[model samples]
Target chain A: MSNNLTIALDIMGGDYGPRSSLPAAVEAVNLIDHLTLILCGNERQIRCELKKLDALTHPRILIEHCSEVVNNDDLPSSALRNKKDSSMRISLDLVKSGRAQACVTAGNTGALLAMAHYVLKMLPGVKRPALISTVPTQTPKPVYLLDLGANVTCDSEVLFQFAVMGAVVAEQAQNIDSAKVSLLNMGAEEIKGHESIKEAAKLLQCSEHINYIGYSEGNDIFSGKADVIVCDGFTGNVALKTCEGIAKLIVHKLTKALNKSLFNKFLALLLFPVLKKLYKRVNPDQYNGASLVGLRGIVVKSHGNASKKAFLAAIEEAVREVERQLPEKIRYKFEEIINKNA
Target chain B: MSNNLTIALDIMGGDYGPRSSLPAAVEAVNLIDHLTLILCGNERQIRCELKKLDALTHPRILIEHCSEVVNNDDLPSSALRNKKDSSMRISLDLVKSGRAQACVTAGNTGALLAMAHYVLKMLPGVKRPALISTVPTQTPKPVYLLDLGANVTCDSEVLFQFAVMGAVVAEQAQNIDSAKVSLLNMGAEEIKGHESIKEAAKLLQCSEHINYIGYSEGNDIFSGKADVIVCDGFTGNVALKTCEGIAKLIVHKLTKALNKSLFNKFLALLLFPVLKKLYKRVNPDQYNGASLVGLRGIVVKSHGNASKKAFLAAIEEAVREVERQLPEKIRYKFEEIINKNA
Candidate 1:
């Protein structure tokens, strides 16, 4: 690897493609002193954006051209089986080949995951890679929730793996050494949940290294009672999207509410600064990156609809993970557990 | 069976016990013209609150005292097996004995459900009861979501039962004569989900009466795409609370954001009406009542922390359910479906 931390960017991915990715990559390079971004996409398109920014003179950014792009509608299997030269795959290859410390993508979620799994494999104890994202909590710090949409029907072992991975991320994101992990259940009861959740809770409680709190209800995710929450991907995905949808619904409803009368509209206009700040606080784009944890390499997935600023946040997330040497740390943690078992 | 609809309320339940329920009952009696409330709890305690409200002289309010109180810590099984004379059970007993058309409570959910099942029994062809609640949607009307926390591990048959029950509620609550129903899944794909959900989808698709749509993701609950979204209680409960948690987190975080500067605080004060309107629109307590559906009798469970107005809202929910004869309508729908199948 080069001396500077290198992050591979899938420039042709997401809705805006290079329009969003290139600007984010350029900004990221300027933000980190020793950072080099391997921007993977069509060279002509990349050059056009670089010319606009007069950034062709920048030594830190390199264009790694890939002809094919993974379309959002393309199945993950199609991307894995057919699109070998696609930017999403080529970018992951850079990480696997040690040319880059990490890879960031705003591509089709399923395709990126399938390609990442095939290219980098998985850590020793992890059967399947999990998708984790930071959620704002009532406390000063945000909590990490894992398996957001990765394993739809996670078994007991996979859920336990999520807890371990979530705990690790929580430690990295927030400086909590022993993050209290809890299984998200229907209720906060020993008798609640499907068999897999109950079984996972039993394992977590028995583990001495992790601070395993029993079961937490969905509300507890924001309650700041636990640093990490583990759940099956199906539940996690539903919960994540539901939160986003409700936020959107509230905004839409509020606009309608405010415009009901002329007095109210004037009141709302006067309150615009406060409302804008409130909107910024809960904006999903602000927390744009989700770590595809458990792969042998570090990969961060940005929201497909991420703005340039939001995409920059994702790039920063990848840099943070790279700085922490997240994959190696996870490997060491797994090895320690294995040694303890032996 | 009575000339006026009578709803039995367990007064000695919930966090504030008689304080919340008694005042709610009085408010409800004044709100609904032909409504009668049977307040079931300790006679002395009920009378004390009644005397304060001069509700003892109110012809619409009836006090039925029970000796025992069911604490929130009381397990469902313990409540069912031992606490037969507890206020929760006694209240349900009124519904069973044809004295009350419905029952309302702000008590421990598990105990209330278990006792209700034992006392009122299930409707024909209905194997289990599901907890149903109305959640605000993008549409003018709120959507009905079932099995909020009733059956953690629901089978295909149970999910189908939820559909039938949900459809009944939607028909009663909203104008759509045939409510479009969707099964909640991790994704919108037919391939995504646990086997039980897949099987439920198959059953719903084949059913003639139900306008069964394909799988809907978490966001669809607020998308106004479906009139009823049915899932296993665990998933539904998780999704419901996650929405509530995110709403709470946003409100909390927004308050912190606004107070950052005196100028911002002043703007917040100017925008107070807009903010208060937004808060009221998404207030959890405003939509406090969760109907326990698929039983022989209607029962509404209010949030334990419900304010007096919220508790009154729960009584209104019970009144609405009674006015429509929700249980009878569900019975007819089930019978029609069963007959069609046969």
Candidate 2:
């Protein structure tokens, strides 16, 4: 709604760093008319990249020089304590200070998560922040899966909170009216999974705000059966990464099969575009942004080895979340649940 | 390597009951010369189905004539307690009584797991039985993934035991020596995953028998980086089912794409066989037998909705395990480790 929608970018993050982020920044500004990007990284490098892209003089792009960079191998605690001036931290800080409405990073996930949690903090009545991402399903719409390596182990209440947050995300981000949510379990049976998951299901069932669908198996993740699927970070991470692995395996298998014969080679050429489109649809990296929800402010995480297009997608996701006022909606939903309980 | 190898089949199991199992049994007996199958189900039904295939009077086929059947919705505890005469339990009983070298079933996983554990019991030094299956990887050889909904939660010791068992299966079943074993985690980093996984990594590293390849993320499951990958049942189940789901989605997506236009439809006809082959290779149901290892006798659990070919595949898997003496190998490995620790 605002004319000046500022988002911060951690240009010093990811494997390629400025090589990907700078171009993504330029593309993002060109794509979104009302968007302003605060590039938080090395001043000299940012200017050089911007000048090469012919966006150096662009009024929408602002540079915030940061001296340190968080290495991929750096421990999250060490990154939090030592790398305050790092681009990842600075981008989060911009969000904290209201200089930016949201921040996007293709940085080390642990470092970015720690920095965002430290800088943005949690929303009222939220115990933890979850990494929620839209995964392609069998249906036309993608389903939301949450707690993707945020908190490895969660109790019933934490999972309940995640379900609420996921519902808000699916509803607002996708503009769906009453998003059906489900707990990711070992089986669809009510007696399945760990006690915590079963307890979370009971809690979700009682909540009138959430349209709590029954348990969803991993097979159900991409079946488009539920709008939002909630699980512990470990399970969610495994499921998401398994999706990545399977997509890669499929592409690999299909390529290998197509490369077998001369006639098949001819078929490959004719089918290349369709196959490429299919790969793009299924490839998790192409949909790179996984939002850190339940925080006071928005933070979108791009993949560590994200391409320029993927980084831009992350920026777009942050813009979407910012426009939707994600945190505020989550806060209001939580407040509603709390008041009802009281 | 016995001239007379007998295996029991739970003909009353699965959705189709005798429909699929009868054909699979006929196929298995025809495929393996030394194989003798004890059909455990309703005598009249088995005779009626086998007569259709002209296999009722086959010399190698014998009927056990169990009256009861385990329903899919039956609780594991109740099934184990009440369904003593059920075909699933009778198959396990045949193995326990040394009447059959191995047992194959396409029953309710929970019920089969419970009955198998109850009747066959665990091998000495084995903490728990795990469901291990081969999944197609990028490599020519498929990798073995274990704990597929067998044990919901596993501690360090249980995981360590699973590693030992998984290694035996990968090495013996695939005819590979010193199979590279990896613990499935959220990240390859030592610092990542839950504490149990990290501790399991340490235990695995200390073992001389196991070729312990540190951590493998979910994406590494089918990367062919490790020969055998182990995780707690919940994670393993999700990952395995996720593979099933992805394969279905890919098939669904490709079919929809092919159906789009006349030109695409023409191309689809040529590519149909290749895609079918790819689907068969990747489809978890095709490679349906998930062996319940760490038990005294071999028990291969086929998919509940297994086709005749898939059930035949399970029988073939059981034959392979019987030939290789999988349970004996696992027992010996555990003994070697225990003696070293002592």
Candidate 3:
């Protein structure tokens, strides 16, 4: 591990803005002795939040004031053209300029993708950057799902590349020697899915570097059959959001069931601890960070409506990626593949 | 339904075949006064099951012996050609020949889709049939999601057709006058999804019959924002299966949590009723029927692993569609749209 590391925090991004990011930044700096956070946002607001948290005088914390903040409703294209001084843009710029080893934001996903791509660019031999996150499964270890709304439509080669990048993350991030990678398809049959998927399967099957498994259905995602599940952005986005929706529905139904009567409510108090622990295990907030991998630099995206803990998790994820040298490892893998193919 | 409604049951389909379907068939006929079932499978097994249920001599129940059965692993095209005398095919043929008003099968989905499409054919101007099923939402009424896995990739026109078909099912099935129809996209923005989604949105927006409510994200599916949500089969399949996956995960987690200690186990016993009710409400087994809409005849595809109760629910759903004359209604809607566009 490096003796010292710096990560840029987009404090003005996300729904809670400085309210969530400031506390997370304070907690992060306090937890990691060798860490420094360059807080990117409105200087006055960041300072105010820091003062409220009683961490304004922390030695390792610095603030870089950004004049504009990217709105959730902003178009990615427009945000790229304009909003040059947005907290989101400045955070990526810091990573690009080598002032920070990584960046974390809980901002507009589309805008963040656009700005990060333009600012940091793709790693050599990489077609595109993918949004990768870990989803809880039946086993103790979670499965890594990728292309979560990065490129909406990935062709055969892009999908194969996602498999490679996803494998690297699963291997390095989770310490798996050979992560079993699977292509997410409508069915497990060889003839299922679009032609692109079939072609991608062929590509993955022939790869010596990847421990590629066969296809995985949506239900198999949480079965822990595969260490990494890869799909196009549209499918991945819907799958991830569906998980979020169902979790919410479960919580809602459970709450309603528990609150029906006074006697039941009293019983609920006794059962609350177990339910709370289960909720924490499956909660989307706990798995907040989705890194935009394949970029030249590390960029971890927290949930837009992130809580302080979720944002803090995002920062920790960025630190881990930096320590693992994720981008450099991916670049080397791709280079080896290119050389082998040649 | 009519005074003497006849439906075909594929007793040799699904994982358990007659073990699940025979009991469901017997119960269905006993539950509905005028409903008659033509149970299609091996005569010996059907009679054996019926005798065990003490329904061997029921007047409303009849048996149509089939020599073959469709396996879940069979390819769609091969199943269509090779399994012509299969129980699944005989059931659909009964519907086609006017011997049955509807057909229910807990068989291979791809095979059923292929056979149904080939036998009944599309309603006059409808492009393709879609697998439509209701998903539980926060509101009292569930939303209808279409193209679950029938067509893997839908173009603009096919997606628009799914919207029309989904709306008809939601309107007639749920008795809503103007069911709110929405195009499912990755994001709820104008420029968020693929071009086909945008074009489908334009078509839906201009439709006089459809109460089109712009775009809906995956999270909004369970938010009760739209009564009918339309998407390509790939996306819908992933979303629906993801729902199933999360529900299973929640149940698994809750069961584990409740079984941790003796005190928690006692609490679980006290909490069993409410928890069971919640599980039933969210259980995919309870919502087993997915009708292949936009065809000339009614066809309900139950879960391949449906329990007796779930298979019975599929029978009930098929009866409901037959009574509603869903195909006729869908045909009328498409005719009206064609005339208006002309």
Candidate 4:
């Protein structure tokens, strides 16, 4: 296995644990070349699952034993403090040392964030790590939204940094140059929102590091107006969840309306092919993972309820992130900006 | 025309102004029995638009002269101070002087809110007004979400009152009794968010005026889990707009994806019927208006870019609000709760 191709995976994380994680790991290993997986969890359970896939008994697959499991209900700090032998902690340690290039988990998000912060540490010039997700907008390319439920209380500097990091990811990972960044506000005016957003607008406007495209209201997020949308965690989290909720509602309503009468049911039958295509486009499960940005290494967080498909997507995302060397690119960008300013 | 059915409409409001307002007024007068409309704006412009409508000569219509107009860019306080002859100011005056049962406008939202607060005054228990809207969810019925874009900063008491008002509108106006009221939070847990939300949860937990259904996150807004979803104006506004943005993105993506190739183009032709039905189901123009709740009477706020169709929907919503006597029902509900506590 290549030295730069190792991933530390928390096998005892997520709702279904080995049932979902094992299949995803196998799929990822099969699809990607020259990759090694350092699995951290209950050794016996993992081996049993690996035994189910006879071909997985390769030199590239290594198991790191960890007895304790970080429960979903456990407080983040408590897991970090008490569960020293937990799978999440052991996987993070792999990334901390030279054993792994990145980490992937569908475990307790708070615990994962805290452990990554305590272990890998933030990159230089990065104040706090932000969670970034690619939202499929109407544009040809997806839009990147950052600080999604990461830091609820953020200042202008934090948001400004988020924009810089978001722009870097969009350019390197998404292969889009000159990424447009917009600050999420109540309105499209310079004087909207509370003190934090207003202050962020001013700082972003002055920063030569990013292509700050002034203010954008929530409606502009998916309107193809900006490539990178930055906001405080509270607002970003609410906005993201609201969009998901509404999409689900719209699909539900369409289905119900189509099934109301015999004539409508016949129409539904005729339109089943198209309706199925539309459903596939809007399903949340297709986009069920987020990446923790501004860290020294890649850390992809999958949904706790993620199935094998979702886990595979997360693993694929981690692979792309490592291949792109996103962290190093961000560091280089920041240093150039700092040197220019100095 | 019934003496109690007079509605003062801002004829010089909105981007289209009397062009959209006059036709909407005629439609309302024709649709609702015993309804009268007092058109407040420049008499000449009102007359010009009125002449376009053959039904403008009906006895139910009256024009009140107001020379000045509140431009969209005017500051709220400055507009109030400088334009005494503005349609917004004159309409509010009609409400204050008991000449009209309600005032509807598509003018500057800030100026309308200020005039609404200044002239109509808040109910005894409400600290500020809430902009409430009915969002059609996946369920057969529409859900009511309050503080859409009104009060940005809200305390526990204010949120509690918004919940009560939202529930009243859902039950009386929308005819959904036993309405489930939910406080929007980051998580469903009791200890989530800042102190205000925690306190609001406690108040809702003990509230008897509405059916409090515990805490709901942003993801639950479109799940039909709650009939009335309440949050501070800042979050509510962001949530509403984000939903709109995502809906537009979905339609845009579908159209683009369907036109990519010959086979897809054929598939698009096959699916056009169902897609058109779904598009109409989620169009914002069909639901383009919001009600300014906690007022002495119904005050509907239509979008500035509202076309004739949107204006027609707003007039229908106002007619329903008047027929339901939403203000009196809210008054009774609040008074009952206050008296019980006292």
On DockQ, the leading prediction is 2
Q: Which stretches of candidate 3 lie over 4 Å from their true place?
A: none
Fnat of each prediction? 0.84, 0.85, 0.73, 0.63
- All candidates in order of DockQ, best leading: 2, 3, 1, 4
Q: Write the per-residue lDDT of candidate 1 for residues B227-312, one digit (tens) a residue.
A: 89999988988988887787788778777877888976876676667666666556553356799998999899988777787788
Q: Residues B1-342, candidate 3, lDDT per residue (tens digit)?
A: 257799999999999999999888888988998899999999998888889999999999999999999999999999999999999999999999999999999999999999999999989998888998999888888899988999889899999999988988999978889999999899988998899999999988888888999998888888899999999998888898888887788788878888889987888889889877777676653356788999999999999888899899999999888888889999999999999889
Query: Can you tell me which runs of candidate 1 are displaced by over 4 Å?
Result: A1-3, B1-3
Better of 2 and 3 by DockQ: 2
True contacts kept of 4: 0.63
Per-residue error at A117 for model 3, in Å?
0.8
- Error in Å for residue A125 of model 4: 3.5
DockQ agreement of candidate 2 with the native complex: 0.87
The 10-residue segment with the lowest total lDDT in model 1 chain B:
B279-288
User: Which candidate, 1 or 2, would have the higher lDDT against the true structure?
Assistant: 2
**TM-score of candidate 3 versus the correct structure, residues matched by position:** 0.98
Candidate 1: share of reference interface contacts reproduced: 0.84
Ranking by TM-score: 2, 3, 1, 4
Instruction: Write candidate 4's Cα lDDT for B1-342 as tens digits.
Output: 443488889888899998888888888888877888999998887787788787657899999999899989887788878888899899889988888877788898888888788778887777789999877667777778888878876899999999999998888865666789998887665545657878988898887777999887787887778899999888888888887777777777767767778876876676577667776556552356889989886788988877776776777777778778888888898899999999
Native-referenced Cα lDDT, model 3: 0.90
Error of 3 at B59 (Å): 1.2
Clashes of each: 0, 0, 0, 0
